[model samples]
Target: MTTTLHCHMPLPANFRADGFLDFHRRDAQQVAERVYEQTLEKGLLWHGQPALLRIALQPQQAEASLLLDGASRRDDEALLASTVRHMLGLTQPVEAFEAVVAGHPQLGPLLARQSGLRVPQTSSGFEALAWAIIGQQISVAAAVSIRRRFIQAAGRRHSSGLYCLPDADCAAGMDEASLRAAGFTQGKAQTLLRLAAIVASGELPLAAWQFAPDAAQIGKQLAAIRGIGPWTISYALLRGFAWLDGSLHGDVAVRRNLQRLLARDDKLEAAEVEAWLAPFSPWRALVAAHLWAMQSSDGY
Candidate 1:
């Protein structure tokens, strides 16, 4: 049986769905798509039943409409609503970040250009961490292609023709040969397997760590894992845990974007970038998001 539910979520003054979705559509192989003029996720579920959710937003509007295609019970509706809020970053206030940006000379113009951008969240922590592993030292296009192959090999199929990202258990159970066949390098495959094992064994406790007070401490813990360095952990915190305070100084793209934004001829070291970002403390992740958005606008 199929059911439908609708919910309205209030948005901050500067929320822009198009800018966020544009950032999301960068992954050409993403399971979600622009469907029927709305952003759609095919395999989202409510109470163990397959559900499809469409997020419809109007620029500058005060609220967004969330339409769920297979939700029945009130609990299912609540779950779906929470998921939508988190995925779209709807709960974050943004006023403080905006006030800070307005006082900056360079960032002010960038902010004006991309007024309502939000950091897009990954579907799950496992998916976020796995993508971080797969994307290390590779072009975004190549990473997306590799990720598509990996998901097809290990992920669960739904009737809607979309695949759910592999959970820790599914990824942990994948053999090395299968991962290699999915275009993973031997070293990368080994690292991924190790990470999956850690997660599946319940050692990392990623969900609980998301609510932890100290992000730097969590980054340290994740860094101790093989193949997870500062960059990977920071990216995971930003994308998976919705950590606004995380800095992406170690990210190559972020560094390049920063240099370009500042019109600097030389590359800035990670320390230099962090120093420059000191004023944006607690909202450094949003600054990184804007840097990424600037790159996207420039067609990079």
Candidate 2:
């Protein structure tokens, strides 16, 4: 049986399809694909069931179709559409962010060059947190390799033959030894197991964190977990919950790129990055994404 749910959502005027598509193409995880620069296909587990999503990007909106083997309830369809919007960053306030930063001496030009960029989120909070744990202290290449292995070891396969990252319930069922076998450090494996268990038991309330008005409370809860720190939490919030205010000043890429953007001879301290980003409150994460996107192409 073929089940398909078609949905569409408005996109920001400056929406750039490449920003979203290129991100998924960064690895050969076989989990998602950029069929072209403007279209994407991803397989994921939704509510413990397999679904494949295909998105077509237009200048003003995104059209998506969710494919499932079984019938979906009306609420499930609605939730799935919401997830797609979040994943594609259609929910972000890009126009407002751009308007606020239009006058900034440093960011104005960068934004002009990287216009329409929005921070994309993962399918679920657990996947974002788990990826952050797997990515700690490793180079992007190394992290990608480990992540691919981890997914193959613990994730579920859709009928389309793509593997989806394990959700909290699946991760909670995973053994530390399995993660270790997938090239995770002992500490990382333990941390992921703890996080998964916490989230699975509803002790963390991670899935609902995005809708919660109090970000500080959510931050404190994430910080209480061992091995998860400010950087991890911030990254998870940006990628998992789609909260754009978390300070990612500790990210090495952000720091390195900032120095390059400023043409500074000295390395930037975390305090310096934090202070520099202070004025961009409520959109600091978007600013960080801009910094992360800066390179030779941006004339930096």
Candidate 3:
């Protein structure tokens, strides 16, 4: 039987569907199915059901439509809507970010150039953690290739030819050889397994981090994991949890963008980046997003 559910979500005035799609398509070549100028498809586990979600933007309109091809239960509509909202960051208002940008001469122009850009969120913290681990110390292209292999090996296959990212259970059960065969180095594979095990065993509460009082505490919990570092946790908080205060001071791309924005020849250290970002305070994540958007022409 074929089941279909449709939902229309209002987009914020400044939300750019193309920018978000560009960002999503950049590192998701293998792990996600996005057809530019058309639709984006992905597999999501919603309320214990595997949903094949396809989203398309309504041209010249301040809204987008979501189609869930595999969802059967009517009750799952709320969960599906929430998932899409979280994924696209539609729930967060950009006015405050625009205000912050208006104060900064360097970042202000970006607001106009990439008006509707939002930081895309991963379907789950587990997926975010997996991507973080896979991307460590590797170029984005190489990381995407490895992630595609890993997903094919462990992700749940959908009839639509899309794959739902593996849950903690699937990841925890993966052996070192299998992960290594997926292009993971011995150390990275071991780290992935260890993290998956911890989450699966309830030793590490991935979802609970959202309730933590501060990003620092979340950082502490993630850092305690075997291979997760400052950069990984920060990136996860920004992209996974949609934490607006999260900054990418330690991220190479952010640093490079900062240099370009400042027109400086010398690379800025983490401390320097942090110092410069202090003024942005609660909107630092938006700053990072703008910086990433500026680098779109050069490839992120």
Best by lDDT: 2
What is the C-alpha lDDT profile of model 1 across 1-300, one tens digit per residue?
Answer: 556666667777767766656645666656644343446454433333444556766544323333333437756566556656776776555666887788688999988777767776765566678888888888788787788788778756555666656777778989989999988999889889998898888887765554342577667778888778877877788777778877787777778899998999999998999888777888998898888777664321
Residue 225 shift from truth in candidate 3, angstroms: 1.0
* lDDT of candidate 2 over 1-300, digit per residue (tens): 668888898887778777787677667555544366688887776666677888889888899988886677768778777888888887888889988898888889889888888887787888888888888878777877888888788768777887766788888898989999999999999999999999899898876765342567778988998999998888888888878998888888888899987889999999999999888999998899888777422211
- Candidate 2 RMSD to the correct structure: 2.6
Error of 1 at 298 (Å): 8.6
Write down the TM-score for model 1: 0.84
TM-score of 3: 0.87
Off by over 4 Å in 3: 1-3, 27-31, 47-49, 60-75, 207-217, 297-300
Superposition TM-score, candidate 2 onto the true structure:
0.93
- Ranking of all predicted structures according to TM-score, beginning with the best and ending with the worst: 2, 3, 1
lDDT score for residue 218 of model 3: 67
Q: How close to the true structure is residue 81 of candidate 2, measured as C-alpha lDDT?
A: 79
lDDT of 1: 0.71
Worst 10 residues of 2 by lDDT: 291-300
> lDDT for each of the candidates?
0.71, 0.81, 0.72
Which ten residues in a row are the worst by lDDT in model 1? 61-70
Comparing candidate 1 with candidate 2, which one achieves the higher TM-score?
Answer: 2
